[model samples]
Target: MSTGPGADSAPAPTTHDSRSTPEKTPPPGTRAKSSMFSSLKVRNYRLFFAGQVVSNIGTWMQRIAQDWLVLSLTGSATAVGVTTALQFLPMLLFGLYGGVLVDRLPKRRTLLVTQTSMAVTGVALALLTLSGHVEVWHVYVAAFAVGLATVVDNPARQSFVSEMVGPDQLQNAVSLNSANFQSARLVGPAVAGLMITGVGTGWAFLFNGLSFVAPIAGLLLMRARELHVVQRAPRGKGQLREGLQYVAGRPDLIWPIVLVGFIGTFGFNFPVYLSAFADDVFHAGAGSYSLFNTLMAVGSLVGALLAARRGTARMRVLIAAAVAFGLVELVAAAAPSLWLFALLMAPIGMFGMTVNVTANTSIQMGTDPAMRGRVMALYMMVFLGGSPVGAPIAGWITDAYGVRAGLAVGGAVSAAAAVTIGLFLARVGGLRLSVGWRHGHPTVRFVPRERREELTAAA
Candidate 1:
């Protein structure tokens, strides 16, 4: 693959050249050097990364401020939950349609519009809050509007990665993106807290509103000719159904998504679990809850970095990560001490992120570029949409039984789903369990059925 900024400008050579230029030639130990940050070598992806760093921090700030503002306004936690629900409601209702639109439109242009809309919502909210005329309804309206924009923005941004860095760097880019988000997550809340107490929420909102300029400018500055543009899907009816059918037909595509659906619905309820564990189980209060979140964020950041370093996404890795994520949660649910439970949050975060990044990269790598938008839309829809349905069940379990039972049930469901899906995938792929010694160590893993006789004879 070409690494230079001008590589896209030249036509490909018909044959291999022994005399490649130094600029295009990779170093002797290129793998070690490039593993963690190979995607940033692309000029376009670098711009996107830089822009997102600024924008994402601002976004996290807004999220903290928004929830806090809603709580203050109504003095009701239920109202705060309602506001959170409104932000995600649009995606649950219309996410697939948004995907169809993304496939039909130019990704960069679509993102510009969506980002602008989100910025407008932020600025409007800031003005209202600053003027002392803000109402709960106005905050609700802004949240919904931002959600509406995200419906289009999420898929567009996801698909656009391929354009910026091409297929070779897709997995690394995606992993880095997660790292970027988690990094912002670590910093944004602290900043928001400072702004809220020292100044007010209005400045945080204003900062978020203006952060859109970074991404918008990045979009404008990107070189159009360098992007690896996919052919846009033509305007047509039944496109949503077509996307669904495409996923349904491919076992490789469908099964991972199904696994994610179950896990996402049941396993990813960290807020409820963490808070309950903090207050009810340990009686450690809000400081402990915040500490738990920070540790998890650190683990998530580590997980993303590891994924990027690995530079490949495999189904087995995804399944193993899913299993580990579940088992870790189960162990943490029964942790005897507050410190032990808090420490376990790190591994839980790491495994959860591994599952996320691995599944995302595998799905994208396997998908047709033309169907990329819709497929990602479905993937995100299942992942994000499941939260609403799952959160209430989790809450009910916590309220009725206890936090431990609620968490244990979720972990059991996730681990069971991973095992079932892993076996099914192995079967479909014509593989069987192989148990033996490899080199010196004992080994047990799935292997191709055709290799069974060869392995037995060798043994």
Candidate 2:
């Protein structure tokens, strides 16, 4: 079903790298301990997770501080969007090639290089801001630099999960990773708000720069022999084209990527929307912005925990979450009061996290290990790279019409895409819509066409 030698189009048998050394099974006695946090039993994964906990908090802090700084300096939402666009533009332009490089390189060493490069950019920005000589352009440059690093870092980190935890725990491990990120999101913004108000954005930037030490140390501490080694793709021409063709032939992989590309490009422009809402619509300033983000983090953390507990990634869940996420954003756009608006951020975040985690895990689980880096790069590219295309447009709409109009437009586009893609997938999968009352409840679902006919005959 795929162009690559052993690419998988389905979930069940696609978890491990067919070309790699035998996967490391969980330690004896731990096999029966399958639970939400089962992946934590792996020593390498545990260290990686702990290091990310610290680093991710710093990441969130930097994000909040950076957006606020840009908004403060320009007083234009468009400029803030431009900053975001610059940061992700490289991903859009060069992500595919980055994936190829990731396939060939040692994931750990590649991450070290990328992480250090990003740290340098953060420190440079911190110095510029602290010295009181920072310009909007300097922030732009730093953001772009980080983007370059992310081109390689994102795909490498994603593919590395299998190496650390193996296929048995991949789903659980991916979910926990999201949970860890959301947990950091909960703390980082609140702290960034205080720092932005009390000290300054520079300190937040500095903190982010220095936070790399933990992850670097963790990487150094990992036992090399324990890793489940997936063979690196040999350098050869048309490898990029090979990865593309592999995905093209897999309906499961291509459809999800297309769905997320639309959502990410249009629906995920929160930096623009939130800042404008806090400043223009609500007049509450940075504190309210941070509060909105924190509440959203609360919902995201809940969603991630639930996903970890579920221990599976289903396409149905992904589609439902995407629809819910879009609808929530539409509701939030018209919120009449600050508190109401803030309260709505939770569901938006929850559904958004659900869509994100489901797509990520499903794609990883379905892909050939040898081709994972490229596939993930395409996934991340569409998911994150769309920001460059979406952010500026969102900002312009906010400036021209209003935050409500801009947000509603984005939500509408997202919802439409979800419904369209859901139906298309259902049809292609040979399922028919089944909507009616079953027992005491209303049921709306898709079933095999033959099942639908059988049900009709029985009725």
Task: Point to the candidate with the largest TM-score.
Answer: 1
Cα lDDT, model 2, residue 60: 89
Give the alpha carbon lDDT tens digit for every residue of 118-214 in model 2. 8888899999999999999998988888988999999999999988888788878998999998899778887898999999999999999999888
* Model 1: per-residue Cα lDDT over 395-451, one tens digit each: 999999999999999999999999999999999999999999879999999989989
TM-score, model 1 to reference: 0.93
Off by over 4 Å in 2: 1-34, 64-84, 123-141, 193-203, 279-286, 396-401
Cα error, residue 145 of model 2, in Å, equals 2.8
